[model samples]
Target: MASNRPAPESPYTTAVFSEDGAERSVGEWNPTAETVRPVRGRHRHRVMKQRGGFARSSTVLGVGVIAAVGAGGIATAQNKPAIAISLPDVDSLPGVGAFMSEDAADGAEADRERTAEYETMGLAAQEAQPTAAEALRSRILEQAEDQQAGAAEAARAAAERDAAEKAAAAAEKAEKEAEAKAEAEREAERKAKEKAKAEAKERAEQKAKEKAAAEAEAKRAAQLAGSYALPTSSYTITATYGQSGSMWSSGQHTGLDFAAPAGTPVKAVGGGTVKSAGWSGSYGYRIVLQLSDGTEVSYAHLSSMTVGAGQQVSTGETIGRVGSTGNSSGDHLHLEVMTPGGSAMDPMAWLRSKNLNP
Candidate 1:
């Protein structure tokens, strides 16, 4: 038979057992049935309370048990906290350490990348410069502008010089032309004056020649008018040829004398040629006449003879005028007739043939 007794409490769960190979509870044990009891505490306590009639141990023994429990709690606290330290869940603590180390390396690599980027930017700034293309374009444009200005100035100066030269040439040409024209006009005027002078000289010479011819004709007409006039009406024969006289260049009278008035007109006894008619010695203003038949007549002692030698006379024309001249005793005409050889002849007889008595 089994007495109904309470089963002891087990200090360890593994120490508890069941009949069917399954874990059982503390109440399953019975003393009267001879079932074993589970022990309560593995550590002993000296200072303990009496359960039925057993004596409790000393306090010192209880203190030894408490000391052992306290040692175990300290050892557990050293191992880990009761709550366990929170971290990334992993199989190995060394692997966690390695992960942290890898994170540090990544941060270092990022720093290095940032530093390199900054250095590269600095290098690019140093290498950069202005573009040659833009600078060259600026220089070329400036030079081109300067050249254009220079060329324009040169062109203007050249134009002005050319215009001045053209003007000078034109002026010179005009001056030369004017001089030529003036010279031509002067030459023309000089030739005209010379021609006029020559024409005037020719007209003057013609007038002089005509005037000389007219004077010669007038003299001839006057001689012809005097030739036909009659002699004086009467006269006295004072001296005869071959008669002796006191006033004579010859030993005797060589001519007859007809006494008349001082200004009586002398006439020709017959038609004859006046061989000599002018002044002579001992017979002033005398005239000598020659007949066609070779008879000679002498008339002297006259105031003047109207006819010259080589002049023809008519019958009874005045030969001379009676005057007292050149050894004449009185105013009278001396007349005589002679042969061809100058021998004196009687003039009274020659006068009777013309119906005139001397």
Candidate 2:
């Protein structure tokens, strides 16, 4: 049975435990109090040394526990205080006494309460802050997104630049092709014009040659006309050579006669020198011309003689005027041809040989 009486105050009180684990205090005689002197020497020194060692060890253990909590090594229990650890009673050992009292128990309880509150606050702070792994992952994701956006922009710009370059090249090619086509067209036109000019020149040269040939032919014909001419113009043959007629001095007509009006001009039959020009017995006026071939041509019936003896005359030159001056009944010209020996021949035949029509 335990007594309920209050224990007496004693500085040397020691703690003892019963079989039931109940605590009790035992009192002892205090000789130091009876002596009435201050405590000194080794006894005080031993007690103070023991107290300092205990305080230092306890402070180190507390700091270690706080550091563990801050480093996230311990899970703080929020709903309870820490379990109290009681020191062993050492009253039976020499120079040792009760290590814990009622006051010490109270202080231990307060310390436990404070430790619980601190743990609770530390856990709350841990919950409020982000973890290291979570922060690192967020930073990595943000950087990756930024890099991806930058790469996409660079690719878009490259594509646009390539497209623009290709478009410019295509336009340049088209321009070159157009210029080449225009040049070819101009060349073809130039060739066509050159061909046309050549053809026109050829045609003009051909026409000039034709005109020159025609003029040359006309000039030759005029030269031929200058070399020959008709003996007389507008005359009619009245009597032929060797014709039977009664108005002849001979038995037959032996000369040609041209009937014309009076005063008709008579031209030289060919180029010659005049041999005679005078009036005769039965002829009113007469003229004779000797040719270069020694042939004599006589005009027996003429009204007047314009040429004198030994005068030079050309073919178709006026040598006498026509009239019936010899033994003729009307105005007519009797033309006779004679050899160099003075033999009579047909004058019409002689005129035909000279390329002339009588």
Candidate 3:
């Protein structure tokens, strides 16, 4: 009987025996018509189909790897975040589903899901990048602030300069005013001094004129005193010429009468030569004098005569003494004046004309 158990497995050998008893290593084995097997049936067909599907799945995976690498390079060149591309599940590829086992299909589907999650993460990173417009706005704000500060500084400088100029102008004006005031004061002082000098000079000239006039008057008085003298001292005129009186021999008095004490001295009336000195019938001792102008003066009724006829006598010389020696009632002297024509004139008037008021 044949054992019901399964046959033992053949061991692996590298040798084969030939029918003529010749041995040969498997490495030198060659297929002949009798040894070559022909495969057939549905099992063979299934194996061929599996090989084709595997080749198609491998090609699809290579295409997906190339696409992912190209996208990563582009993202790097643009300075953007890395991006992930989700590959399609290998079991879903054409002809690949037939070759893959149930477990392989499930793993490929999980890898696809993971790739999509990474792609979402890359999109979020790209959204966070700063834009060109935001950077430009920040730079514009900084420039505006700088310009505002510069404008403020310029305004402050301008104000200070204006203030300094105004101050200088004011100072100059004040200086000019002070100079004008000083000049005016000096002019006033000069004018006042000039006026005072003029006044002083006028006063001095007036005083000189008055002094000259006084000196001239004094000289005139001296000349008149020298040329004439009073006839007698201490005498009073008792009668005048052309008067009516009982003591006069003529109807009207022809001479002036000077009444005095008995011994009063008589003087020459003016400077002249003595014409006559003697006693007459009606006239007591008397003297007659002849002046330079041919006029004659007579002193009568004297007690005694000191000058005689033809004797030269000067003014103010004692000629006689008073007495009642002529037709007189008392001790007196008669004074007579006779012009060059022998006409009798009033002696008192004649004496006054000679600047001698007696």
lDDT: which is higher, 2 or 3? 3
| Local accuracy by lDDT, each model | 0.60, 0.69, 0.72
Q: Which prediction has the highest lDDT against the true structure?
A: 3
TM-score of 2: 0.37
lDDT of 1 by residue, 1-358 (tens): 4333444444443334445556565443222222312222421121111210021122223333444434444444333322322222221333222222333334435544654564445334323212333456578888998898889899989999999999999999999999999998998888888888888887778777777777775555454432332246467767776788666667787767778888788877656789988879867778888876677777777887788999988666666677887867787877778888877776666566645555
Q: What residue pairs are clashing in model 3?
A: none
* lDDT tens readout by residue for model 3, 1-358: 4333432334544465454546755644332223322323553356445544554455455545545554454444445444444545454555444434443445445544655554455444344333433455578887888888888888889889988988999999999999999999999989989988888888888888888888886565455335888898888988898999676667789999899999899998777789999997567888889986788998888899898899877778898899988677889999999999999999989989988888
- Stretches > 4 Å off in candidate 2: 1-107, 125-136, 210-358
TM-score of each: 0.35, 0.37, 0.37
Q: After superposition, how far is residue 72 of candidate 3 from its true place, in Å?
A: 99
- Minimum summed lDDT over a 10-residue window in model 1 is located at 44-53
| Number of residue pairs clashing in candidate 1, backbone atoms closer than 3 angstroms, sequence gap of 3 or more or interchain | 8
